[model samples]
Target: MRILLISVNRERMPYPVAPLGLAYIAGALKAGGHDVRAIDLCFSTDIEHDLTRIVEDFPPDAIGISLRNLDNLTYPSSLSYLPELEETVAIVRRRTPVPLVIGGSGFSLAPLPLMRRVDLDFGVVGEGEGSIVELVGRLEQGASAQGIPGVLIKGEDGFIPPLPLASFHAPDRSVLDNERYLKEGGMANLQTKRGCPFDCIYCTYPLLEGKKCRMRGVGEVVQELKVLQAEHGADYIYFVDDIFNYPADYTAALCDEMIAQEAVVKWTSFVNPRFLTTALCALMAKAGCQGLELGIDTGSAKMLRAYGKGFDKEDVARAARYCQEAGLPLAVYLLLGGPGEDDATLQESFALMDRLNPTAIIVMVGIRIYPDTALQKIAVQEGLIARADDLLEPRFYISPLIGSERLIETITEAAMKRQGWIVPGLEINISVPLMEGMRKFGLRGPLWELAGRMRRPRMRPLR
Candidate 1:
């Protein structure tokens, strides 16, 4: 069976993402003896032409489109590229009659309605490796897709039973042999584990990955790092796990293995605030971990409870202090507006930010409601949404009790008073001329180009 996987993520944020999910699925299918190829729309200039050519050349038996994100996942708005995705789907459909399956970070979060809108034959609810392989096998065997686990069919009477998550070794990077992309500012991403133990209600990770956190062996992780460093010349890595420090001992062991193997690649990962301790921080730093991103979503205890963030306010502060004392650069991520978040709670968040003063703080001020997540339930119950099934126009941002715009204003005002605090990229109100100038030149282009004149460096006057 020949499988063609399409990654429908084109917008690149400040961070570097390598579309590991799609690559993992391709690896699994190939491992199962099925021919597979991946078409990434992120770097592709002409998606339609490229996809058409691939279909004509490869003539895949099944097509899987990985929806990496719901329009960059920026708060206050869910970006929609439905028309573009639909067009790709149409092109694929027209060129070949292969089965179309949609799965990825975004589809994992909102599978049902996204499937309805995109006109995919089916979609995997969560996790693509096992489900994708099974789907391909069933289709190959000419078996009815009726009882396939983790798969959804159009007009199906009920939801498909979720498949038990599969535990596999670190992905075979050899599947996508070219490692040059890693050296070109892309983080060699690795997921050492899946799922989050902490019940952060606002998060979609726990819901998507399930409550039970499954991990790959520490030795396997070390081996992958060694391969990346040696074969790929990967110097920077980003662990995209839900919580890098979930099992502190396991994390420490992995760090030790990396150190033992001389895998001295600079790395960064998100760690749960409550679980991280001084020892853990020290171990990470010694293992070449350059930075730590902590999910200190809020400082108010009430807001924390509302969002089901298992950790308390003190836990965040302690974790921040520990990371700081351990000489690790800290980046704190916070959500500004959501249920039970009021002016006072928002103020407390800022106060805590001022007190902790981590290396940087990122403020996210939008609520995206997925079907199964707690936020979606709350949205439906609060009349913010009509039904969970009506995912056609994904709606988010519940500021009715306080007003979403007002919330943004307050957060912006508070953020402006502080240094090293970053807001959502989409929300930033840059001048149109400046944005046009950025388009003329690359992101790292000289400011003098946009300034309309280059002031040559002048030798300082002799004093």
Candidate 2:
């Protein structure tokens, strides 16, 4: 089968993210002896024109498009991206008759709603490499699609039940954006595991990879890192795993194996604050772990519990200290306002921020409710939202009880004082080229400039 993979993400908001997910799927299909081509909407002069050219030239047997973010334009600030997506799809449909499939981190969050809205022949609900490979094979052989896991097929009857989640091989790094990633001076993204056990209300990981965490063998992980270093000259890798700290023994063994092999690639990963300790931090540092990003969504334990985050604010501070002690940079992720948030709690968050003093603090506002999260239920019960379809784009809030006006004031006052906090809504950094790009496209102007200056560097909480 000949395949064409398109990444439709245009928002290079923070960093120039290459489409590792699409690259992995492309690689898997190619490994299975299919021809593959990739196109990123972000790099094109005109996405429609480039997409037309690819469909004409390659004439793929199947087409896979990734929606990394549904709203490249942020929520509350902007609305539905379906129009942009629909426009892209129409152009592609006009050029080719290939099966249209949609998958990505963004799409995985609300698959059913997206499937209904878009003119897709099928949709991959979660990790797409294995599912796409199987779909292509079945389509090639004219096999019945009834039993394929993780596949949502369009039929005259209506959308069919998606296939059950199927087990498959881990993605090899060769499948991702090598040249672009290299040119951007970015680290290769590797997933040592799938899924997350923790169910933070705002998180989309569980919806995409399931709640039961699965790890690749330590030997497999080591071999892949060795290949990345030797073949691609990749000295840095980002473990795009949900929780690198859970199943501590696996993490330790993987680190030990990397150290033994002298595969000293500097790596970063998401760490669970509760599982991290000083000894574990020491082991990670020994293994050449560069930094860790902790999802400390709130400094208020009440807010944390409301969001189903299983860590306390005190543990968050301790994890930051431990990572810093072990010579690791820490990135702290903070969610500004959600259901249980109020002025007092947010003030406490700022006080906690002063104490933690991470390398950087990312303050995102509220949770975006999708079809599967507990947040969706909460959204309904609280009358914050009325339906699942509200997730067509990033419909979000700071919460009425917390009150958007007050939340913004609180964030503004804290950011005015905190040198280490980076608030995107506030736009603290003026010179980030991505901001320039957004301005060039008429997204926003001096407002973004204000945001740039107010933003702080990224902080890591644990190794």
Candidate 3:
């Protein structure tokens, strides 16, 4: 069976991301003895021309489209990718009559809504590596894909629960042009693990990857890093795990393995402050961790509890101190205007950032509410959204107490006073041209450090 996998993600605001998920599915299919070809549309200038050429040349038996994001997630300047997705689907349909399948993090979030919105034969809810192989095999056999787990047929009322994988497939990085991503996107992405155990209210990671953390073997991770460096000329890597520091023992072992194997590749990942320690921080730095991004969500203790972050301000401070002592740059992410946001809580966040002085402070104003999250229930109870709202159009929950206008004003004012503070919500800084110019000059990794070198001038909030 010849399978055509298309990555339909084109969001390149802060930086473009290569479709690691699609590559995993392609790897799994190839390992299962199926011919797989992949196309990344992130840098595609003319989607119709490129897609038409591919379809004409390969003429696939089944086509799988990966949707990474439904919207930009930035408030005020939010852009929906649905139109682009529809355009891609239409182009593919006109080119061939092959089965169209959609599955990715974005489509998995609202599979039913997306299915209704666009014309698709099937949708895979959770991890598609296993399900996609089975789907393609079934289609090759000319059998009905009625009972496959995680496979949703067109016009189906309900879907079976997605099966959990014990381990991940060795992603076929060759399926896409990784060298281009390294040059344009700043860093190549790899995942050391899957799943999240945190109970953050507005998060969808637990829903997407279950609560259990599945760690890849340390040796395999190190080998993949080596391959990325040797075969692809990738110097910097960003681990796309939901939380790379959870299961502290596994993280420590992985870092040690990287050191033992002498992979010598610079990397960064999202780290939870709760499990971070001085020893672990030092080990990570020794293992070539260039930077760390902490999803602190908020700096106020009151808002931390309200947001179900499971960690307090003190934990964040301790983590910051450990990173500082280890000489590892830290980037802090904050999500304000949630359920308990107010002027005082906002002040607390700014004060904490000022005191800790991380390498970068990326702040977002509103919480994008998704279904099956604690946030969705709270939004319904508080009358922010109705029970039946599908939330497919990117509705955000901004605290009525703080108000959107005032929250933007306050954050913009505070960010202007500090260096290394970025507010994508305002669309003030981190332009694409600026990032491209930096990457062309051989800058790699998360360029947030350089992006935050100087304080940005005040600009009108994005309307």
Candidate 4:
């Protein structure tokens, strides 16, 4: 089957992302003896015209659409991409009558609702590699494609179960514009593993990729890094893994391989504070990791428990110190409001962030609730939202303990005093525009470093 894969992510606030997910699927489809081609809409000037022309010239028997995110995932603006996605599907449907199969991390979050909205012929929930190939076979044979695992059919009740993450491999970079992506993005991206084992309350990673962590071989990962360096001319890489440092041994082994091979690619990723060690921090820096995004959601231990994170205040502080001592740039990400969140916890978290004084602090004020997450359950039980409702349109769970108004006001006042601390949701934060400008000047690899370097704690009277 000839398949045309489309990447529908156009949000380029931080930077235009290379469609790594679709490339992986394209590789799998090719390995399965199928003709595969892809068009990344991230850089497309005209979505409809370009997409239509691409379809007109080399129409396929099937089309796969990858939706990487539901929204901007920022606050206040809370821009929804559903309408744009709907239009993209409409354009494709007008051009081709082939099977419209939707998959990707975002689609996995609200597949059924998205199906209803987009008029897709089918949806591939979670991982699409194995499911997509099996699907194409059935479609090509003109056989009943129903009951295929990991596939969601319109008007169908259940989907076929998905294969394990171990079955997937690193993405195929041939279909991508590596140089262009690297130029605009300031760095290339690679995924070393799939899945997230952590029970972060509002996280959608596990729902998208599953709870069990599945990793590519250390050699496989390093070899890809070498390719990025030599073939793609990639100097910086971002390991798009949801949680990179987990199962400590794997992280260590991967770092060791990079050291042994002397791979000349610097990278960064989201680090699980629970397992971070000073030794591991030193190893990562030695292995060409330029920075780390610390997923320390909050500082208050009580709030940490309420947020369902596995780490405590001590764990977070220890990890911060390790990164600091290792001289690794760190971006501390904090989600302030959740169940049991109050002014005290909020203030405490603020104080703690002030102490960490890492590279940058990204503050997300409200928790965007997704189906089946602990946050979603709490939102439903608290009558914040209906349990049966689809949350595709952006339903955020803000703690009533402090109220959104006061919470935003306090945080805004606090962030003004602290440079490099950004809240992109509430107001127009400087990071977005600043990073975009920096990218123009050829700076990349998680622009949070810019924010961190700009951070200068100002002395203010205690309230």
Candidate 5:
């Protein structure tokens, strides 16, 4: 089978993400004895022309498109990708009659809505690699892919659940903007693990990857990192795992393996405060971890409980102190004004944040409700949304008690005073062209950090 995997994600506000999902699917197809090529639209100079040329030159038996994100996930600024995706599909259809299939984090989050919104012919709900291979094979054979796990056929009633995320497929860089994404998108990313065990209310990890944590072998992860460092000249890497510190033993082993391999690639990841410790932080730093991004959620334990966070404010503070001791820059993420938010809770958050004094704080006003998250249930119960509301359109929960106006105002005011604090974020201070210009001058690892460092001189002390 001849396959074409297209990545349609062009949103790079925070940082452009590599199309690892598409790369994996391409690898799986290739491994399955199929000829595959991937086209990434992230750094595309001309998507329409390139896509047209590709379609005309190498027409594939099947085409799989990956959608990493829908809206920007920002509350008020909700920049949607539906129009762009629909246009992408229309362009492909015009060029060729190949069967259309969709998959990715965005597609999986609201598969039904996406399928309806974009009028998709086929989509894979969960894991894409194996499912895509099977789908392509079935398409090649002109047979039904009815019972294949993770395969979602058009007009189908149900889908088979994907197998445990134990198997790993290295990305197919042959069909990627590999070097460009590695450099401009901040850094190369390696998934050391899949799935999350914790039940966070607004998180889409569990919905897309499941609750079962399936970590790859430490040695395997390190080997991949070494290859990225040596072969791709990747100086820095980002672990795109849900919880890098979870299953403490796995994280410890992975860090140890990186140290053992002498992998010179510096890395960063999203760490859950519950599993972080001084020992682990030290190991991470020794293993070449330059910084840590902590998903602190909120500073008030009351709001923490409402957000379904496993760690409390004290635990958060302790984790921050551990990162500090390890000499790691810690960026704390706070999701405020959700189910149980008020002025008191907001005050408590800022008050506790002062105590923690993280290297950086990223604050978000409202929590977006996806189809199957606990936040969805809470939103419906709280009358913020109906149970069957279309979540693909970016509906958010700001807690009627606190109100979004007040929440945004408080966060904006606080963020203005607090250095290294970004309110209503998922953004960057510098422009893309300026960042790219800096990247050419050999700058990397999130431009926002530099912005944070520069702000210290002008930032006023929060009262």
Candidate 6:
């Protein structure tokens, strides 16, 4: 079987993320004895021409399209990728009569709505690696893919819950242009684990990957890092894990393995504030972790509980202090304007950040609500959205008390006063050209340190 996997993510704002999920699916297909080829539309200048050329040249038996994101997730300036995905699907449908399958984190989040919108033969929910291989095998046999786990038939009522994989497959980097990602994006990405045990209200990670953390073998992770460093010429790696620090024993062992194997790759990951410790931070730093991106969300005690964050303000500050003491640059992300957000909670967040003084503070005003999330339920209860809403189009949860306008204004005012504060919703601190120039100058990792160094004009208070 010849499988053509296409990644339709073209958002290159902060940085272009290589389609690691698509690469994993391609690897699984190859391991199943199928000829797999991939097309990354991230850097494609002419999508129609590229799709035509690839279809005519390879002429695949099955086509799999990976949708990375539903939207930019930035409120006020939110951009949807559905149009591009629809266009790509239309082009492929015109080019080939083969079966069109859609999967990836974006598609997995709302498979039913997406399957209805896009003309696709199948949709794989949750993880694609195992399900894709099974679906392909069933297709090859000309059998009904009815019972396959995670495989959703077009116009189906409901999807089968994705079965847990016994083991994970290594991603096939050779299937895509990895060097370009490393050069253009400044870092290669790999996953140390799947699943998120945290219960954040606005997060879809647990739905996409089960709540239980399924860690990759530490040795396997280290080897992939060495390969990324050696073969791909990637000096930096970003662990695309939900929470890299959770299950502290596993993190410690992974770091120990990386050190023992001399992986020598500078890395960063989304660290959880609740689980981080001084010892773990030091171990991570010793294992060549260049920085940490803490998803602290908010610093107010009330907002923390409202957001269903397990960590409190003290934990956040402790996490920041530990990272700083370990000599690791820390980037903190705050998702303001959730359910109970107001002037007091917002000020608490700013005050806490001022005290902790992280390397960078990336602030997003509104919470992008997705279906099947706690936030979705809250939105429905509050009459923000109907219960039957599929939420295919981007809808955000801004507190009715504060409203979007005042929320943005308050954050923008506070961000302008702080040196390291970055409000992406208002486009205050970061820009694409600036990031490109920094990457061109050989900067790597999250590059939050450099972003923190950029100056912001302080604005006077409105009387």
lDDT digits (tens) for residues 246-280 of candidate 3: 89999999999998998868899999999999999
User: Least lDDT summed over 10 consecutive residues: which range in candidate 4?
Assistant: 454-463
lDDT of 4: 0.85
252-302 per-residue lDDT for model 5 (tens digits): 988888778787568888898888899999999998888989887788889
Candidate 2 off by > 4 Å: 72-81, 155-176, 388-390, 434-463
lDDT of each residue in 132-162, candidate 2, tens digit only:
8888889999886666667777743333344
Judge candidate 1 at residue 431 and give its lDDT.
26
- Which has the better lDDT: candidate 3, or candidate 5? 3
Task: List the global CA lDDT of all models.
Answer: 0.73, 0.73, 0.89, 0.85, 0.80, 0.88
Which tens-of-lDDT digit does each residue in 23-103 have in candidate 1? 788788888999888777766788889988988888888898987766655655456767667878888888887789888
Every model's Cα RMSD, please? Answer: 6.0, 5.5, 1.6, 3.0, 2.7, 2.2
Q: How far is candidate 5 from the true structure (C-alpha RMSD, Å)?
A: 2.7
lDDT of 5: 0.80
Off by over 4 Å in 3: 455-463
lDDT of 2: 0.73
Per-prediction TM-score to the true structure, in the order listed:
0.89, 0.88, 0.98, 0.96, 0.95, 0.97
**Model 1 compared with the native: what TM-score?**
0.89
Going through the candidates in the order shown, the clash numbers are: 2, 21, 0, 4, 0, 0
Instruction: Give the poorly placed runs of model 1, Cα more than 4 Å off.
Output: 174-180, 183-185, 425-463
